[model samples]
Target: MNRDEVIAATRQWIEKAVIGLNLCPFAKSVYVKNQVRIVVSEAKHVDAFLEDLDRELEFLAAADPQDVDTTLLVHPTLFPDFLDFNEIAGIAEEAVVEHELEGILQVASFHPRFQFEDTAEDDIANFTNRSPFPTLHLLREDSIERAVAAYPEAESIYERNIETMTKLGLDGWKALGIPGMGGEKK
Candidate 1:
């Protein structure tokens, strides 16, 4: 798909995932890196964003499932180059950070191709330590609570992942290929 199409599709997928998991609007924005940085915003509109993501992932997966594994490390934060990592970090609460990190790690671990170490500390540290690269930011209001209320299962999964990551150590996290500051991929 073209860049515009890819952006649109990514938004859709994000919407579906949120609706499917019943997540709340805790924050907005996602970052990813391609040949260059691309930022996809307007994520406050959960439905629209998720729809776009769903389509994009489906297209990529259909083209080649291996692409998913290869590109997962591309860094979603590299999209929109306008935002700052510290700014995004400021907007996020400990709970939200824990939740997202856990969910992503779980997904990565379960994927057939990626070999995510079963070390939560390692994963969390690697993710949190990532360099600030502005990409897509979802503008959320009070949607996160709604999502949690609607999708209890997804919430549980997120919680489990957070707990697991918390147990891992900084050294372990460094072992993972998580990015450092300034979008430096390790």
Candidate 2:
């Protein structure tokens, strides 16, 4: 997919699955307010991707909360394997510390094949972090703290999301038409 198509698919996934399924209670507010910035990276190499991530991390750190609460840096074709993407995700976290924004910013990851440790590849719970493409979510620490404070029992969100996806099932997920989930292979 082209950059525009990739972005559109990501937004659709955010809307139809993230918000529609209430996978993330904190997502809807920023998303509806247009504070969520989705950037599709064309970086083909790991070095280029890290550069993109650095730029985005700086951008998000400097951006105002009302203007940009979070950023999703997506790469359509890089890191097809979950393990490689997972390693890159670790590097992203290191980048946060390298930039000296460790306390102010955090990196979250999502991929089409996002599988948690010890979980089956197709476990419904993994869908919680699954996205159309490989994505690095840059979020403000202050925003997260505030959101967590306002949200009662924020710890339950994960379990709730798992339950939600379990009920949705693969067929239900497929029915949502999320990009990259068109087959039964994943």
Candidate 3:
């Protein structure tokens, strides 16, 4: 897909899956305010992708949160496989620490086939992290702190999501109409 198509699809997924499902609870505000920046990476290799990631991190660091509160580096071609992306996820996190932006910036990952440890690959719960593409969600920790503080019982979000997914089941998730998310081959 071209950049525009990639961005369109990503936005649709955000609207339908993330906001529609109320996964993060904080996503809609920044997204609606246009503080969310989406960049489609054309990197074909892991090394190149890392470079792209570094550049994005720097960009986010240099940017004003009011102008760019968060960013999504969408990589549709690189690391198409979940494991490959998952394996490299560590490096991504390390970049944050390496930059000494540990408490300032954080990375939230999503992939077409996102699976968790010990869970069955087809587990419906994996949908929590699944997105239309292997994308990196770079967020400002201060924003997250504010959101969590304002949210009562924020700690229960995860458990609530698991319960929700369990109640929704795989079939229900598939029915949501968000393309490229839900069910198996995790």
Tens digits of lDDT, candidate 3, 2-55:
888889889988997788888879899998999999999998788999999899
Cα-based lDDT for every prediction: 0.32, 0.91, 0.87
Flag regions of model 1 displaced more than 4 Å.
1-84, 88-133, 153-157, 162-186
Identify the runs in model 2 with alpha carbons over 4 angstroms from their true place.
none
- Model 1 agreement with the true structure over 1-186: per-residue lDDT tens digits: 244544544443333322222222321222221211233433444345444444433333334322232112122332333223333323333323444432221111111111124643235523322322233222222333444566546546556544544564444443442233222332
What candidate 3 gets wrong by more than 4 Å, as runs, is 182-186
lDDT of 2 at 181: 67
Taking all chains together, each candidate's TM-score versus the true structure is 0.27, 0.97, 0.94
Compare the candidates by TM-score and give the number of the best one: 2
Reference-based lDDT, residue 49, model 1: 43
Q: Is candidate 2 or candidate 3 better by TM-score?
A: 2
> Mind giving the per-residue lDDT tens digits that candidate 2 earns over 1-186?
999999999999999989999988899999999999999899879999999999999999888889999999999998889899999999999999999998999999998988899999888889899998999999999989999999999999999999999998888999999778653554
What does the lDDT read for residue 20 in candidate 2? 91
